[model samples]
Target chain A: MTEQGTTSTALRESITAGLRQAVKRRFGAAADIDAVEFTSLGGSNRTVLFDLVDGTARRRLVFRQETIIPANSPFLDPARQFRVLSLLYPEGLPLPEPIFEFDDEDSLARAYVVAFVEGETVPRRLLDAPRYERARQRFCAQAGEFLGRLHALDPAPAAFLAEVPDSIDPLATTMARIDRWGGVHPALELAARWLERHRPTSTRRCLLHGDFRTGNMLLDEEGMRAVLDWECAHLGAPAEDLGWLCLRSFRFGHVDRPVGGFGPREPFYAAYASASGHPVDPEEVRWWEIFGFIRWAHYNVMQAYGHQTGARRSAAFAACGRNIALIEYELLMTLAGHYH
Target chain B: MTQDAPSIDELLVTVREFVQEITPQLDGRDRYHAQCAVYLLDIVRRELGADGTDATAEQAMLARYLGDGAAGAAGLAALAAEIRSGRLDARSDELLADLTRQVVGKVRITRPDQLHPMHRESRPAE
Candidate 1:
């Protein structure tokens, strides 16, 4: 993690300050905002849980606001993110309840408000190391099931299509993004090019949890409470989720394990297939896997620059920039018929 | 060294070292590319461990499949371009399979087991 000072308390004060203004603006005069606690900080924004706890008042509620600009800055679009998520998931998927969101940049620079979801997202406990091992498979299965539910969502074209920009092919947009970073490593040129050639197209489109992985989902002792981070959410083929979950990079260290080092590909695919009633498509899986590798390499390049500029510095980010080479090698092998 | 050779992990270490030293002095995006070089090393290393093969065997497999001439076919980039162009399909499936086995052995590192053991997942299982 970047050594950005945890001015989180101070930031919490700032958010409380902001929320007090919001409450006064909306409720005018008698807004009894009780408390705000700084709960989480991540690569994108500062999150503070604002509690309007008037226990007897039927409106006991909490919301999240993106306050601080964490290192590389988060890709979340507070407005589009909440709107599309609400449309696609519609309370079916485990996700945040968006009471209100603002994209007017001026509101808080890079700010958003979401319902405070109380859960632990430190997946290592749920995957590898103990104390949570008994809950591992079930937890992993729940994460998969949530994503399965996500992939199973039909945004009904009109609402979903309206949210994403009119000018971009979701898959192509993703490929273009990967390509934008293609200039990074010569080692990856071949893989990047290979990914370009093999990019998959899925007409059976659905709302894709573009960044679905262990850390992206929020979990608790019971299981996944919510799948957070809709920053990269998009409309695409379901296989993208499959490929992303299985990508080796997400495995962290247990390279032997797929699905973010949580479990095997079959069970994940089985869970998704069962949810969607669509059997897994390995070709599509390969296509999406290639895309996943492409995405990984691209992001590594992006983060490498982040490390260099000293915007963010971490073993993983540094390791991430270095990780693209491995992604490249995988790409070349894939192109050379490695997985064929 | 045994016939298995330096191992992918060892090779990766070399690449990582290269990344550390070579990353500087390059300006603009090339600096980013350097990061990828480092990452590729890790990927190769992982695959080497996963596949239990060395560069020599991989090279030999490629050359044999290409009928003693494949490695020189304009580097990996050109080879990839050729593959994309479908020009390389001129080679027989046996030769193709040999080249494929080499590549497959490496890339399949991410998979948990030998479902097909030779081919990419054509479609998900029943």
Candidate 2:
């Protein structure tokens, strides 16, 4: 959070003024915009919260804008994000309701406003807090079942996704992105080569929540409420989502709890199999898990590079460069058959 | 070339103290940033304390694996491209051992805490 009287305050005020008018025009009502506040410094988008007072009721809405400098991920696109939410929201998925999206025509920066759904998104808190005890008990099986249902959806209707070239051959696309990051390591290189040789050819393709991990999920006392961060969603093998969720990093120190630090991997797999009618293959999931580590390590290095190259300046990113070594350490441990 | 009063070690200690001094005063997001600042300084301290042979050993492994004298990021990039293109065998035990050595060497400096509990017993003496 920036201090008051800084340049950020001035910019925030200007954005609030513009947003007040935009909200009135979109809602077709003279609603009063009480205040606009920055919520999170997102990786690919800037998130803000504002309240709209309509007569006697007040509604809290969130606005997400495509960051000026986006993270280097193949699956990120503003239009695709909107399209997925628009499609999934109707299918009864627990996610924020889309209010409106702006494109080139809108004078304000390209962004979308949605209903603010609150819950816990942090990992350690979800893992350790007694408040989330109920959520922890049901999270793994529910998350697996939810992902299975998502993969069961017919991706054909979202044909606009075909415009994104990397929708197919995610391995080659990931390899290209890693090479462009300019930081290389033998462990990552080995993982990529090994994955290339062992990549599975799925008989069935479906939409994958490319980042369905604990940190991305919002949980309450009841259980998982909404799966957030759709920027990385894409069409791929169903097991890829499972593999990513079980990655050691997402486990947040509970390496024993392979399924998002919630429970063992078998129960999660069993739930998914029962729900989707597709038997889970453990070997394929392991291969994708190795792929996940390599992808994550490369991403950390890329984030640091983003700061180093003047594309973005962040204290957190500078720290991320150092964090890559930790991921590389885990990558080697997994590759050497010593992780388990 | 003139005499400097504060050595690198003293500078690191000063920064650590400064972070401690300001930590209690900050709350919420500012506190998190301060913690991150301290973490960066800790990494710098570890880097300074390392014996500094890790890079040389890593380069040697890269040279051996690539079967050429290639050494830095350019060399590693070329090697990665080779492995991806099937010019080099990625399944060889010797290659795996060298890559493991490289990863272990890095983690020793950047984050020894991540080293496997079993592997920690075999860490080379400084």
Candidate 3:
């Protein structure tokens, strides 16, 4: 059967009842579950928007729950995400505040709730909407500065973050992940070999926001309000984030601007260098961009396999198999020095 | 010799019409899935149209690249393993050219739109 959003009628009712009891127990007062809307983000977690009412006090919260859906990253545990948020939110970084985490027997799922950051997370709207015109103009430089600060954080103190494995050799790890899937596209295979051979040496390693791109960021009338989706966070070369941001898939046809379709790469790199006190290497970033496309292609192929094998079935997942060709074409162009 | 009553093109045209009729009726997640369904059908139709030529050309290219009768995915996997283990040079002009040809062929079938404008204007020689 077609997978609807995480909440069916029965599940919704049960969740609301359970949530009411939990909230009451925590707050020492009765709180009504006004409404619950389950929004599927096509990840391992189910995004739930729920309203809690206590007299005039009403709070709209985002409750994330682990689904049966296979996670894209090995490091997507919500407990780890809560730990990351605990550090970032206090530093005045624009992120959802981690409210509470629940894993008790009475709780419906392994879930955590956070105060929702209001904005449009859709890539197209963030890119094209006139309301976001001002936001788009300032986003690239802001993103660069933000990332520089993130990468400069003292990772020594964050022992919990270390639980997510450090990818000492990202190229080898990425290649292994692709090989494990056991599907061969000759272009992908060749690209992998090229990347492996030409792997750059990175001097300093820091926390990399594994999926830093336009779509993962939240935009509003003002500008980029908050960075969302921290599932892929890990300790690696900071170039990982920069390269991922410039990937063709993340750019959404704004090929000219390598930084989130906002503006030129020069300004972004300039800001990052100024803030981080580290020199930005375009070559290193380009290498990661190529790696991003390869990783994304492998992901699409795996998604298609998931559909075919009946591990998970969806029309969208089935269509992902065809998307590998487009990604492969981009990979060839990038390798041939045709695509930027 | 007589063909089947519903030709492949005829079946695709009917499917297109059905999709156009049904898609507007769907909303929210269902509408999204309907769009994916339409796209999948279109890809299938394109694949069916070019199946013979692409398969034959790909097999021949694969055999030539591997320098043996080994062709298709299994052959490519073995070649990839060799490259991974440092036996084969991935940076060689021969391997790059062959891989480009293979990739270009795939783009023609699955995403002709992504091909460079110059290449798209002039379809690759058979």
Clashes of each: 21, 0, 0
TM-scores for every predicted model: 0.65, 0.92, 0.94
lDDT of 1 by residue, A73-167 (tens): 32545556666666755646778766655445334544555666776676565665665565566754675566667666655652444445312
Give per-residue CA lDDT, model 2, range A144-226, as digits (tens).
Answer: 78988898889897666655544677677776776677677666777777787777866778887788998888898889888
When summed lDDT is taken over every stretch of 10 residues in candidate 3 chain B, the lowest stretch is: B117-126
Q: How many backbone clashes does candidate 2 have?
A: 0
Whose lDDT is greatest here? 2
Residue B95 of model 1: what lDDT? 36
For candidate 2, list the clashing residue pairs, or say none.
Answer: none
Q: Is the docking of candidate 1 incorrect, acceptable, medium or high quality?
A: incorrect
lDDT tens readout by residue for model 1, B1-126? 465756656666866997779789775345655765565555556655653343455556545434565553244434444454555445534434444444444445533242243355532221
Tens digits of per-residue lDDT, candidate 2, B1-126, equal 765979887899899899979999987666777888887887788889877577777677677766668887777777677766676774456767766777777777666777877656574332
For candidate 1 chain A, the 10 contiguous residues with the lowest summed lDDT are: A181-190
Give DockQ: model 2: 0.57
Q: Candidate order by lDDT, highest to lowest?
A: 2, 3, 1
The lDDT, on a scale of 0 to 1, for candidate 1 is 0.58
- lDDT string, candidate 3, A1-340, tens digits: 4445434687777767777777777666766767777676754567778887888899999887776646445555777777788777787888888888776645665777898888888888888879899988889888998899888887764555565644456666666666666577767767777787788887787877788988888888888788988877877889989998988877777878778777889889988998799989999999888898887887787788788888888888888988888888887788878889
Candidate 3's C-alpha runs over 4 A off are A69-75, A163-166, B1-3, B121-126
